[model samples]
Target: MCGKGQLVTDLESGEIACNKCGLVSSDRLQENRAEWRTFDSESNDRSRVGSPTSLAYHDMGLATVIGKANKDSSGRQLDPSMNSRIQRLRTWDFRTKAHSSTHRNLLHAFNELGRLKDKLSLSDAIMEKTAYVYRKAQEKRLVRGRSTSSILAAAIYAACREMQASRTLRDVANATNVKRKAISRSYRILVLELDIKVPLVDPMKCIAKIAN
Candidate 1:
């Protein structure tokens, strides 16, 4: 037991405990925060215990993923014919989840979002904002036939400008391996169609971002 200890909620068990030592001090842990969390102008609170809403997944981490295994739950292999059937089911199942054109676009864009989030070393807030803007663009039919990577690069670039995260179009273009012109075009579409009101980032911030 550490001498300095404080109450820390075990997010998994919902038990309040000491931070230094994992000792439960209270049975009831309050879920109420002093203020509501609005990450990047969006409140992504899907009502589900243990599984919080996250931008990392195409379906906001809510889609049920069927495991890909030939073996059954009992660890016994299914009949070859049955395995074939299951394989088809699995493929269709994945297809069904993102059946619509908008959903399909989101799927690919989210995947690219994950890649750029890591490559650019972006924060969770930026990632969330990027996903939000992309979703809005999809809803507005702004990403009708554009490449997923290009659209996603534009969204991330807009998010950086909206949140003043110090990322430029060129930075996002390089990170996503998309052309700057494509990103800029999609970005303009996003800005106009979605009516996104992004405040101008400071000139000093731009200079600092370029220097970095």
Candidate 2:
């Protein structure tokens, strides 16, 4: 006969037995020990926040600038949109504060930003990229059919519209030393080759962004 909390078993002829409580057979228990090895000691430390030597950083100011550019001008927080473009802008911004360079380069970027802003189509990120792109084009001698200044202006205008900056072609042209006609022509060429998009700006979005 089995008592409380005990097991009863029948033998060949019909005998009964009682077993100890809370007893587990060794064969019925599971082995659950696990071993882990550390790889951190063997791996190289590869943590970096920004490319301090990159030209993009020399143009945009820092990652924060690019991040701010992606935000609504009203400074309200929202879900981050256009992650790819934002990253590109962040890279450009880094060039501004991280790189070692001359005042001329800094001045050049600032003037470029002013022109970009005047266009009502260019975003801060697009402006920075356009300047960086122009510098690269100059180094590669790939410029064609227009003066470098005009080409740069056109690129800036194109970048602004592509990245939804809120600038116009005429405005960017007026801000540059290059003639408006040349800027126009270069703009057409860039549009044809780069397939840039022109986006609509809604004041409500800006307001909603600001009001919050």
Candidate 1 lDDT at 6 equals 77
Residues 49-125, candidate 2, lDDT per residue (tens digit)?
34333233434333344445445568654455655666766777666553643434545555655654544433334
User: What tens-digit string does per-residue lDDT give for candidate 1 at 30-66?
Assistant: 3332334444446576342445566656787767767
* TM-score of each candidate structure, all chains considered together: 0.65, 0.38
| TM accuracy, model 2 | 0.38
User: How many clashes in each candidate?
Assistant: 0, 19
